[model samples]
Target: METIVFPFSSKFLWAKYLLVFALFISAKALIKLPINGTIPAVIVFGDSIVDAGNNNDLNTVIRCDFLPYGQDFAGGVPTGRFCNGKVPSDLIAEELGIKDIVPAYLDPTLKTQDLLTGVTFASGGTGYDPLTPKLASVISLGEQLNYFKEYIRKLKAIAGEEKTNFILAKSMFLVVAGSDDIANTYFVLRARKLQYDVPAYTDLMVNSAAEFVKELYGLGARKIGVFSTPPIGCVPSQRTLGGGIERECAEDYNVAAILFNKKLSSVLNSFKTSMPDGRFVYIDVYNPLLGLIQNPQKNGFEVVDNGCCGTGNIEVAILCNKLSPSTCTDVSKYIFWDSYHPTEKAYRALVTLILQNIIGDFF
Candidate 1:
């Protein structure tokens, strides 16, 4: 059995928080990164998009710890990432020149240096809604937070209290979730449809997302970026299930995502205004991804509605395997690697576009 740690009991951790608060109160009303400050690490949370193999060891069917998943990765060995290769977490870290890859916190083979830098706690098939992970038997966001706390302790052991505190304060935090909640739990499963309508369900998601961000702040994360839900209706799997005859984007799903994104952006803006000591940025991945799906050729992608794997209609997770007929010969020409996730090439393109715009937001 494994022991799970909760609560920030260390006096050193509390002292670090108090000291930073005092500095903010006396020196400035808002917190600002020092001119020479550098982001020491890239910490991540949320679902499949940023999950760096966190679900590999978990007792869940929602895993891709086998062939064809990491075919584009180094040595073509599947490291359990839910894509053809590196996901956004790895791309962001690589872009920042921090490291080539961001390891998962739950990975047993994680080295000390990996912890000292950063790691992801994201799991595939998870969402902001509590029930989403339950349906898939995956790690919940709350459990991911617990793992993060455990990670902090290990980081302290490796680098000592002072360096640990600095890394927590200076690190770049990324949150990418909500797609599964809308696509799987609410719409496809019809789990929350009876309890709440579209607007109300979106409210539940935004509230949960806001609460999660606050908890991260309580844990010493200062610069955090939360990605808005993509146009889930346009993803191949959703199109197959909901797009009727023509196999177009599912309008209802896109509407729900738009509702959530609007509220999420507003809430993040409010956080920026209220929590002056923290940098809260809402990253809009919706429009960028939507553009890719609508105009594939502009980005050198031939297929946008379907994924590069198999028939690309509904294959994902266990459904997407090497046993499938075949994968596309040229993954770069397709925006998505599976029914749910983008290809490494597409992720790299999106990360490049995002970094060009938001890199200055953190420091």
Candidate 2:
């Protein structure tokens, strides 16, 4: 038989094979893989507990847009934030490698760059009802939802519909409200005393919260995280008002909060069952916060019952933010930053618990 000699040498053939293998490896390495991590954006709605300075731009006395508020931060300048450093939402973004600053919705100066990460519609002293007293021109939950809708529209306009959909579908939705409803409206303002009994009032709060969640789902929020009310009675302002110098928390308010949370959980479970596209998660800030307050030593907190600023009374209005307001030397030692909000250290601890699978099943 005529020998049909190969044109290439053995060395050349080996070299070709090696090149093909290298190419294969390079292609495998270059291919993008689907990530099972958090979404690119986070849309927050609620009260001061999660407010990332939404009230800063507002012409309100309840604003924290001044010095000493962000003292523990890198710049050591207040960014209108309520905490000494960062809040729970800020930490959540940090955990996900997202932006550390959650932009305020009404900030006229906010650029497109700010929107790429996320925005917070939460305002200090805001609640579900519009009937509540206007606390320094803050937005209500309904208004916050409307702002969220506008934000989605703005995102669509910039990133196109597909990108916006992806963001809403995968991004986390955090709602931390209802504390103001109890502290400001119900107990202090006596809105509940006028309208309904304790149990009835709790039902109303939970029902309103459920309705708000439903509205968010309609607006395309998929992964939802709702923070139930903390021990509202344990707040310094409430403690001061509850008794005569004992600083004892009002059990009545605490009981109402418990009932509200139970009902809210049930409503969330029902939503998950009914809405196939929705993922409603409940964050229990009540027990963890209460534990920290009851046992400050266990949580590394020093002043659990009093705020770090002012007279430690129920006077955290605009007057507290005066140019020469009194402030503590070490804010980390205090649980409450003001009468109504938590310190940055406390918020960080709470955020750590939320991100470390303590409430993972709900999410």
Residue-wise C-alpha lDDT for candidate 1, range 39-116, written one tens digit per residue: 778899999998878899889888998988999899998888989999998988787667789998888888777775
Whole-structure CA lDDT of model 2 = 0.74
Provide the RMSD of all predictions against the true structure, rounded to 1 decimal. 6.4, 11.3
TM-score of each: 0.90, 0.85
In candidate 1, how many Å is residue 359 off? Answer: 1.5
Give the distance in Å from residue 326's predicted Cα in candidate 1 to where it truly belongs.
3.4
Q: Model 2: which ten-residue window has the lowest total lDDT? A: 28-37
Clashing pairs in 2: 65-80
lDDT of 2 by residue, 110-207 (tens): 77866656888888888765655274378888888878888877876675565567678767789988887777778788766778787887777888
Which lDDT value does model 1 have at 160? 67
The superposed Cα distance between candidate 2 and the true structure at residue 188, in angstroms, equals: 0.7
> Which lDDT values do the candidates have, in the order given?
0.87, 0.74
